[model samples]
Target chain A: MRRLLRVSSFRAVLVYLGLFLASTGIVLLFLHGQINRALTSNNDKAVWRDAAMMNQSYALGGLSEVEKLVAQQSQLSGVGVYLLADGLGRYIAGNVPAFPAPADTQMQEEGWLHLRLQAPFAEARARLVRFDDNLVLLIGRDLSAQQATMADLARSFFIALLLLAVFGVIGGGLMGRQALARVENINQSLRAIISGDFSARIAPSSSQDELADLEAQINQMLARIESLMLAMREVTDNLAHDLRSPLTRLRARLEKLSLSAQKTGQADDIEQGLADIDQLLSLFTAVLNLSRMEAGTGDMQQQKIAVKPLADEVMELYQAVFEEAGWTLDYVVDKAATTAHIIGDRHLLAQALINLLENALVHGVGSPPHLTLSLTRRDQQIIIAVTDTGSGVDDHQLAHIRQRFVRLDESRSRPGNGLGLSLVDAICRRHGGQLHLSNHRPSGLRCEICLMVRE
Target chain B: MRLLLVEDDPMAADLLIDRLRCDGDIVAYAENGEAGLAQATQDAFDVLIVDRLMPKLDGLTMVRQLREQGADTPVLFLTALDSVDDRVAGFAAGGDDYLVKPFAYEELRARLEALMRRKQLAQDTMLTLADLTMDVIARRVTRGAQEITLQAREFSLLEYLLRHKGQVVTRSMLLENVWHYNFDTQTNVIDVHISRLRNKLDKEFSAPLLHTLRGRGFVLQSADKLGDL
Candidate 1:
């Protein structure tokens, strides 16, 4: 739950919902105040008009005329209340049965008084006017109905605001959840790609909304990255190939001189020169091949080949070399995956496997000389691993070994361009796979290439 | 062999031409594809070695034109572009062989010799190097009366060496022609396989048919030719 709230989408939704809640609350409060003010003003205006009329009636025909008008208006409900009282604080003939005690002697002193006309009557806003000969008139509208209606409106507004708040939070949370799911899908693919599966991509969602647009934009970015990676790789490969030409001509001239110098016995120095040139050339070629595979632009004929036979073929090719080097060659295939197949370029995969085996033969020939090649079927993957029972590489150096031109301290004297594992890593990536190097238990190094299998 | 060399680098061309001449072959030099096409058309050459990038006409277009004109002289592209796509493009333009530049002179000579010999050899089932004979149809090998048993890869390696019997077959050549690998490994894995194959072919024989030349490559020569060299 905390994780969901921490997601950026969820937090944005929360912020929007909070703003909505506050705005709606303010609007509801303002609306309630406006309605209350209008109702009170209308009540006050009716009271003022009744007061003027009562005073005019008193002027026209004295107390009897005022009393008659009050008596006539008092019979109607929700109209003005009329309380005609003598100076002794006793009620006369009017709708109010008794004079309110607070309005007894101070009738003329206060201009307006809010008082209950009777014990059961609603509150009223009345004007206290002194008539001739100390007679008092209390006239105002009953506020019960207006007050009830205002209360009802206030209740409905609060209910509506509450409901809106509840639904808004739910809708926003649901939206955030949906958006987070799609984003997480994209994140999963990007993570896979970061972990060396360059073929990975964001999975598209169902709706053609903004999230879909985002997915499209992100997928476009990945496509561009993939292409740029290829172009960079091509540049390096072209550079290597270009370098080879002049170097080749130089070596040719050197060989010619060396052949002529054979009479003076200076050919040995030239042979060393030629050897250095060959080393440079082999390194150049290795880099070119590695880049070509990484670019994924070579003529790779992908086909569905049974996994075991492919492993068998590579093992057959390397077994003789291992035996010649006095290393025991062992092979194993998981019985369950005997019929497993993978879609890949056969020769490239074979080369990758051979490179691993050759790496063992070159660097892993320690005290107990043993190299094991195994093929196992994993979930939607085929793992080809070569383990050498020797002094394994340090845990720190194991990761660096897969990078280009990264040779360990001990293997510096070995006859490698230091691109063996690098090329295998590139080939595995091209096949939509990964290469994992780990120090095996009891002094050995395990190099595993996990390749996606053909369904 | 009479060879036509089309190259833009003057020094490279001179060195290559001089080396080819020292190996007892007649050579003609063309600084560009235009001159190369003219020379190829004017004279009957055994092989045409053309550089890929040149002025006036590129190697591919020139080769395509030569092929269109019904000239069957084998053409080899000596280029700096070693990408698989580049090689495919070279062959698509009717090139018989493609060798990247900065090559061992021996390798270049061997490829040309192979190209020329490819035209001379008849389409026969049997391939013979003195007493050793291979039946291409049966995938069998026999030396005199003794039958030789071999693995599939070993058989292919032996077949390639026997096809270019007396030529200096470089390791890269064997890797490309036999194993179909375009890259080189620092380890001498190919040499190991070649040594094993040599053992099977010459272990019990009187005169070794397969011979390795230091600073060059392996050559399978008949007993009579061995003394001549």
Candidate 2:
């Protein structure tokens, strides 16, 4: 709940609503004060007007003025009857309860007014008029009904203000909730993005607000980063594959140069030295091949070929070599995937397999040497198993062996560039699968080509 | 042996041409792939060394064009770039071999010699060093008239070394030619086989034919002539 209010805009909305209610209360109070003043002024004006007319009637009458005034007041209820009191505070004719006389003396303060909360009799007043000695006039009126009406008006105003307050609160809460929901979505996306989901993207909002623009900018940044990462990987891999070929050639010539140099003949020594230079030249030759692969601008004729046919062709070609070496070579193919087609460049695949075969023959010679090639479908995946009962590689160290130019100590005794397994691994990854290495029975490494079965 | 060199880099071409001529192969230079292809097509050259990427026509295209025109000449690319795809592409385009540039003249001469030998199409087609003789076509080996039986890998390794006779064959070279390893991997396969080859070629012979240059490579030559080098 507190998290919702953490938003600056939400707090601003709360402050705005609070001030709105406070201002409404202030305005209502001002209006109430104005109504009170108007009511009091109207009552005072009515009393003054009635008194003036009453005085005129009394002044016009010769002897029955008191009786006439008494007859006028008889039609109005709550309008108290009154007549002039003698100068000694004696009421000649009035409805006011006569208070006990103060000491038989006339009231020194003549124009005195009195008000009280009585239902029928509310206000009274007396004033002295100097006429041929000393005369006095007294009047009274009830104001209870007027007070009750004013109280009723105040109650109704409060009820109306209460209704306004309720509506303001509900409307304000809904508006705040909607605004908060929009902000929360953006925050959630940012949090997810920071957690390392480069694939994550903010939902494009239709609202043409500053937040929407921000989301667009963030998405663009993520795209650039992803592409750059891909580009960097391409560069590194191409360097590993392309750079080492010439180095392989150069190293070959160098070894030969050192060989000829051992000859006692000076000509042979010079020729041998020149051979070292030959290796260097060869090293400089095929460097651009990696760049070409990375660019992917080469021939676009990738095709699917049966693994058994290709494997059979390579095996037959090398069959004599293996036979001459006095080693047993066995081959098999499952009926289901008899001629399972693997999609790729034929020569590249041949080369990839050639590496695996060479690794086996050279590394497989010491321990009950036997080379077996088989193809099968397992778990909806096309698996080509190449097992050899020979000097098996350690599974723990197999991962490093796949790295370019990283031949293991045991395998290095045999002739090879370390790129064999690297190429194999690259081909597998490109094909949307990977090479699985495992131990075979007795003493041998089994290379399982874990490839995607053609859908 | 006259060789046609097609390279765009004037300085590299001149230096290589001069060095190759010094090493005894007749040198002919072409500034661009087009000129080189023209020379290679018209002339009777023993070996054609090309730069893969060149103006007027790329090395691969030029080679492919030559092959299309019925020229079965050997081609070798000289470039700064080295990638399996590049080499494969060049080979697919009908190139016989590829060499990355910034190279030693010695390595250049060896490839050219190999190309020349291949061009000559030697009748015997044998791997031989001094009294040691191994016929690759017959898959037979005879050390001074005594037949020596060798494994397939051993025979292939010996063939590769014999192909570039009078040179130190590095582990990498044997790997590529014999084991077909294009990536430079530190593998004991080369060393183990070389050790075995030394045993086969020298253990019973009066003069050991295989000499291991410590920290360098193995050299197959007349044991009588092998000096401290």
Candidate 3:
């Protein structure tokens, strides 16, 4: 019984039964009150009528005749009459061999009828009358027959209540069990999915219910996932073709050049060939790395990397480059113990930062020719800023800067494929972070790499 | 160097044949696995370079057949299949090295050299580079005859840098080569060990060797900017 109530649907059934039984019980109580009143009053009238007829018989005949009838009244059926006179107050007639006077006293006096209740015959009625001042006539009927009828009614009502209780319990249980079975089936399917079987799905129900609708929705979600997987595969195939084909051709060409230089003993040709090949390989591999980052590979290596020190290191390494390039380099590292830790791969992070800084440096020599690098932490985020007082970009150009191999220069070229900001964007996203670009105060393009500070 | 180059695609075969000859390795090129196997039975080479998914016979099946017949020549696989599972499959079929296609000529040359060198030395080996020597069995190192103590990881790091001496090994290279972790190339373990390694290599010496090229990566060499680089 305890376990049955533990199920919510089962508990709901019990609550329904409780409400149902309470209302039915109230109606039954009201009906029982009405029936008892009506039945007792109805019996009083019938018994009174019979008592009046016996009184008439007593008045017509004298006491001796009455006495003789009374002596045989036990043998006589239907009504019983007993008479008690003024002086004796003893039984003078029918079925009362001894005096049991108090019950019929009210009937003996007047027209009012009385019903007396005793152990077995709870519904008994009587009436009496005084005839010529010397004799009293009493007629009373013990309604043992009426008592049996009321007992039968009570028994039948008990049987009805018993059957209702038994049937209600079984019906409620079956309904709860059916509902639970559907829920359990859905739960099993969901568990299978959680354990990595994305193909697992809830069994569809024939009935058009909310459960069936939920199953249909889950299947739709799974379809979307499957399509995404297919798209990823297609991208990988295209990457292999486009990146590797040119690379293979370029490598073969370089090998032939080197061999020719060796055979011909041309010193300048050897040096030129080596330089050109190195440049091509570097550029190709960089582009490949950037594309790979963009395609959303798993970021499996993550650790607590202190950002300020890392940013400082990059600054130090490039400081000489910045100075020799005739750019005024400025830096403002936060003094507020800005050693914020973030979960990331250091090399990837460094690569992205290097791209942004180099972009700033290259852009610096073009216009106002000054660069600024800053690292700071604010509100559970690590922000590294690389600002250059070059031709600061407008909103449109700022958005375009992160597109693949996008360089806005109409001049010869900017040393790279213009993928610096794009690589920055990709690396930030891999760390559950983002790259935000905005105009620095009055001048310069500010590249902000915001990452989740490790807790 | 004598070699067998097996490839199915006509374009790929022509390019590879030209490149290997330019690299000055005597090459035997086969377009199918059957012809390649017949050549292997008739001749011996320094290395066997096979391409996967060939006509009539796949590369892995041919390699397996060769191994079954007690042919023990070192095999380097070249395939267009880039998936990690494909690599495992290639190696499981008795390949000695796996190279995804579109490789740089220099990378190919370096790998082939390493393969041949390792074969000559066998497994129980101590390795050496200019001014640095390391015992593989003892896990010990000495630079210019001066013995140095290093952490276990530091020893491994130095060993890797020394092995690939003069080449500009990227952080990714060190991560995979020394740490046996091919995946996460972004780890700072490479950076930290490079720092520790520089302190031991050239901190007390006249010049620093582990030069961190600005946007590139760490390279193991002398402190001065090498004129070629």
Candidate 4:
């Protein structure tokens, strides 16, 4: 119910219903006023005609003729009521029994009055006129019909407002629910796709509506993505097959040569040859893994992962490596941050951290490689940073460091194939995170991986 | 060790067989998976090296068949596909170990030796190399009545070395079998750990049991010992 109210269309329905009721009320009021005016104007015209007739009778024959005329006219079956009285305001023969209080005496001005008639006490609207000799007359009409008409109109307005509210809300709720369901369906399919199910696709309907058109477009896009993923997998497989075959044969031949060379008492060349081959193999493996990660088709499993333990394990693995490389390595895990967990492949996370630490150790060698690895919580994310006290990259070159094979040194004398940071960046992105490289103050590099704490 | 090498590439197979023979192991070569499966079932072999992609029958199918037939010979999958998913698939198909193509001969030899040694050493509760002794269940190491203090990870590292005492254990083998890491790090992290282990194992003793064989790997044996197995 709360979710339904949150739908924008439902809110629009409420606003529209309110507007409809207000306009209907205003229109009904205008019509009621116009009808009442027309009825009252007709009554006033009839009263004036009867008053003129009474004046003519009084002129022709004195109060006797006026009295006789009032008596005859009052007996007629019509809306008008007539009254005739003397100078002392005594009621004479007429339909009305007595004059109403504060009756007008002026000949030109007509006084309006409300009066009750015979049994059942029907209400009437009357006007008064006085003659030159203090003879007064009253003529009026019944108002029950007009009043009934206005009551009926008001009742109809209320019924119409009730119906509008009922239908508007019901219709709006149905439409909002339908739209929400369609959007949720699309969202579910998209989520499945993101979780490594490439075959998942939005189910489209047969209707030619806008929603169906959108689904169709989405399905087409997914098809393209699946094909592209397949092509990438094929390329990686083919590259592995074509290149590693010859490399394998070469290594085998090198082993044979090394054995024969050992017999001949000259084996240093074989050692150098084997070292170069190992470097090539490592480079090959790193590049292949980097590409696989970038392609978003890696065998990564997303599970609830605690960040502190992962950080500690990688740091432990690299601590002695740093010491052997003549660098002092230190690590601290914020206890408060240990509770933060993420959904990602555990091995990938550990590997990315190891790469960053190794990068610092390798490049930070020009100075004494004093490194600090820290894990902390930052705004719905866990930040794992490796800071090295060594020369950082140039400001302009920082942007290019995460690109493939983009070593900054012109000499290219470094042991890496320049894909370490790139791989870390790819792994971070795969986990819905990011890799940030910044210069630590007092001359050093700070590499951090920020992973979201989804829970 | 009698080893079966199932590879489609003739030249690579010939070179590998020659190298294995030179190392004093009798190696039987099969040109494809069909021939390899038949040969494997007909004879008793210590280890089977099967290539992933082969003509007539693939490595996974042949191994799966071998496993179904109750052939418990240890199988190592040799493939150019080194992705984590590929490795998972290789292990899923009843492979005991996975070695990517273009591997160094020393790595291959070390892995084969480790596989053979694992079969013979699975029942042991204690491991002793020279005067150094490791009580596996008690998690204690002592050398000539002197108890050696080591961290938890260092203890496991020493245990692995003592189990494969006479064999040459390569860095990749340690990383895979002991650390359970399928990928390699840029730095030689194994070297550092081995050095620390060396310090604790040999710094106070006259005969150093842990020896670094330069480009080869570490070997745990008494210094007075002279011959390879």
Candidate 5:
């Protein structure tokens, strides 16, 4: 509900409804005031006209004539009240039993008297006239009918307002939910694309609206991106094929030369040439693999892989090498990590772990070089960390190592082509995971491959 | 050994043919996939060495066509397309082995030998080279009267070496066959493992059965018989 309220479209609807209801309330109140004034004016005018005729009747025939006119007028109009009283305030002839008490009479503007009377006629507006013959005549109209009409108008106005509010809220809620659902659909498609499904696109909507137009535009953009990515992949593959062929021929020739030179004096130099060719080949292979992985064009055989066994296998492959190098290598699997499973390509994940282990073997040179390969589960992620007790990278250089061919070794004497960490990073991203490099407390560099655990 | 070489580059083909001819093999060469397929279909070669991208028909399609015509010749793909997907595609097209280009000649020779030997050794329950014997059914290895206990990985490594006894077995062969890993590690991890296996198999023996061939690879053969080659 809160999310629905946050939607701009739904909020607009609420704002419009609020303004509409406020204006409706103002208009209804104004109408109510005008209706009341018109009815009261009509009542006051009827009383004034009746009083004028009673005054004329009294002038022509004194008290008897006035008394006759009052009785006749009271019987003719159902809502009329007429009264003739003696000089001592005693009622002589009238529709009401007696004149109203002083407390029940309120003097209105312009000689109008508002009376709260008893039974049948609940209220009245009257005018009092005094004669020279010691008589008083009162003429007024019953205001019960006008009060009832006013009450009815107020009730109808409130009911109409309530209906408008109920329908507006319901309609607005539905509109907000619809807009939210469409937006969610677009978000889902975008997320799929982000996760390496370049073909994902938002479903076309039926209704013609701004959101529908946006969806069409997004789908068009996705198509364009997908085609461009396909073109890029084709170019990369062709380049790899074209470039590696010449390199292969060169290496083959070198190998041949090395074989013939074995009987000659410069066999060592030829062998070194062959080794250099092999190094170049390896560098080529690594760069190609990294670029493919980074572009999300690498083949991924995704399956549910048990974390412990994968880690153990990589550790086993390196355990002997570490022993041979006179380095202490430790493998630790947390209880949770043992059972944790991740959806990824086993070959690539194994390659990533091997890269980290190799990184440690080459650069991790402590007094007695120690390397730890540990797997632990944290929240929804399975972390495989390779920590080496060596001189950690300088704080500034740590971030640079993962970039392609960025070597921290200033002398450039290292055997690596500086693509191992970059390859590991690309592999991690291809698996929808991340590679985090941080310096271990005190000393050493720690590289962690954090992958999402399969449910 | 009889082999068919189907590759586009004449220079690379010539170098391969020269070295292979020197190694005492009968070689047949084709410059394109069309000519290669025609030659492969018309002849009975021990193994076929094919490059993936070629004129007329690509290696994958040629191999597919060859298989469709019921030829079961062992095939080893030698190509510059080294991605995992390309490897898988090669195998899917009826290739028995996949080797990336810019490869060591010894690696190619060893792989071809392994491919040619595959059919003959498929159902062997026991593998033996001289006095060293492995009972594949019982999972046992013995040198003469002495029994050798091998770890699981070491045992598989030994099995692979024994399967291709007297032939050069590269480090990558061991890693791929024994550990089933396709990617290469930066360090000499495989060498260490091989050394460990060597220690167990020949440390106390009078004759060293496992011999490292330096730049070439490792070969499991009796040292006394090595000079006969």
Candidate 6:
């Protein structure tokens, strides 16, 4: 419910409904006032008509005739108020027992007076007429019926407004949910694409709405991107095959020459040539692997790999190397991470960890060159961290160190192709994970490969 | 030893055939899979070196056809395709070994020898080289009368070396056969493990059996035997 309320379409509907109800309420209030005025005006006109008739009677006959007319009007309709009073405002003949208003009350426009009367006539509008014999007549109509009619009008208006609000909320909720679902479909497709599924696409809706148009445009873009990626992958594969064949033939020729040169004592130079060619081949292999992994075209044999055992194997491979170098090596697995398993290519994961260890062995120089390989679980991810007690890189250089052939100034003299970290980063990305580099606390460089833990 | 080489590249094939002939192995050359398959069916060779990409028929299909015909000769796939999937496909098609392009000659020789020795070594519970003996069933090792202790990985490594005794087994062969890892490490991790195993097996012995052949690889044979070579 809260998420639906956050939808822009739903909020817009609410705003529109609120404005509609407010304007409707104002219109109904205006109509109510107009109706009340019409009823009161009608009542005043009837009172004036009665007063005029009484005045005519007084003119024709005398006070006795006017009193007889009032008695007849009172008997004909119970709603009518008729009074014939003598000079001092005492009632002579009428349904009312006494004058409703005080003697000092002044008349309103056109000789109209509003009266707040006693029991049986709650409110009234009246007009007074003066006779030549110092007699006064009062004529008015009861207003309770007008008040009742207005109350009925207000009740109906409230019911109509309540219905509008109820239906608006329900309709707006439905509209918001529909829009949210459409957007979610697009999101799910994009997420699949991000997770290395190049074929994922949003399903086209049948309706010719704006959202459908957007979906169509996105599908076109995805198809274009997929084709471009496929082309690039083919180019890389072809390049690997084309370039490696000649190199392989050259190496074979060199090996053959080196064999003949052994008796002539020229084998050392040819051996160096072979080593150089081997280095070139390794560089080619690293570049090819990195590119394929980054392009998400690398073939992965995914399986459930337990975190602790994988780490242990990598550590065992490197433990002797570390010991020979007089470097202390520590391996730790957090209790929680011991049982953590991730679905990924085990060889690639081991390769990534091995790269980190090699990076440490080559660049990570310290008093004793201590190294630590640890595994820990954080939320849904398993972190495999390698820390070394070496002088860390500059904070600015840390960001670019993972790029291809990005060796630091001091490390240029070292024997490295500088593609190790880039390969590690590519491998991590292929597994739907990430490679993070930071300076370890107190000293040294820390590299972490975080992979998602699968249930 | 007799070997058959089925490769598309004439220059590479020529160089490889010359080297293998110099090494005292009889080599048969076929320019493509079609010719190679014909020669292989007509004659008997100890090992078949098939390149993956070839004209007329690819190496994988050739090997598949060979296996379907019930030819049990060991086959090694030589190709530029180094991906895990490609290797799996190679093995699935009945190739006994896989070697990526631009590999060292020693690496290829080591793997080919390993493939040829695979069937013979499977039935042996006791592996012996010189006075060093390993009882595979008991998981015990002894040099003459001294009982040797080895970690699980060290024992496996030594067992593989013993299986390929007197043969030059490259570091990659050790990694693949012993550790079962397909990727390479930047450092010489295998050398370190080998050194540790060497210390335990040869330090107190009169003759050093475990030997490192510099750029070639490692071999397990009596020092007298090595001097003869």
lDDT of 4 by residue, A207-238 (tens): 67888889889999999999999899898889
Model 3, runs deviating above 4 Å: A1-187, A190-247, A250-455, B120-122, B125-149, B161-172, B184-195, B206-229
i-RMS for every candidate (Å) is 2.4, 8.2, 7.3, 1.2, 1.2, 1.0
Pick the winner on DockQ between candidates 2 and 5: 5
lDDT of 5 by residue, A129-246 (tens): 8886579877788888999999999999999999999999999999988998999899999977766778899999899999999999999999998898899888888887888788
Show the colliding residue pairs in model 3. Answer: none
Model 2 spans with C-alpha error above 4 angstroms? A1-426, A435-449, A453-455, B14-26, B38-44, B64-73, B81-85, B102-105, B125-130, B135-138, B167-173, B211-219, B224-229
- What's the CA error at residue A18 for candidate 5, in Å? 4.5
Error of 4 at A328 (Å): 5.1
Ranking by lDDT: 5, 6, 4, 1, 3, 2
* RMSD (CA, Å), each prediction: 8.9, 17.1, 11.6, 5.2, 4.6, 3.8
lDDT of 1 by residue, A1-455 (tens): 77678778778888988898889889989999999889878888887788889889988999899889888888776557788988875787678887666654233224666676564466776776778567987677777788898899989988998898788778878877887788889889987665445567898888999889989898999888778776876677568656866897798889899889999999999989888887777777777777667655555666798888888766766778788888887798887577888877777788898888888887787676999898888888888899998889999888899989888856477677778899899888877789999998888899999988787
lDDT of 1 at A403: 89
Residue range with the least summed lDDT across 10 consecutive positions in model 4 chain B: B220-229
- Please estimate how well model 3 matches the true structure, expressed as its whole-model Cα lDDT: 0.69
TM-score of chain B of 2: 0.82
Between prediction 3 and prediction 5, which has the larger DockQ? 5
CAPRI band of model 4?
A: medium
| Top candidate when judged by DockQ against the true structure | 4
The TM-score each candidate achieves on chain A is 0.55, 0.45, 0.48, 0.70, 0.73, 0.80
Please provide, for model 3 over A16-129, each residue's C-alpha lDDT reduced to its tens digit, 9 standing for 90 to 100.
887877787777767776777687677667656655655666668866655565566546665443444443556565554443446643453346445554333343456555
Off by over 4 Å in 6: A1-159, B130-138, B142-147
Docking class of 6: medium
Classify candidate 1 by CAPRI docking class.
acceptable
Better of 4 and 6 by lDDT: 6
lDDT of 2 by residue, B99-203 (tens): 665554445655666676664444558666778887777899998889888877677777776666555655555656776745543234456667777778778
Model 1, C-alpha of B84: deviation from truth (Å): 2.4
For residues A148-236, could you state the per-residue lDDT of candidate 2 as single tens digits? 77788778878877887677667666766766787777677765444333456778888888878887987898677657656764665
TM-score of each: 0.70, 0.44, 0.54, 0.82, 0.82, 0.87
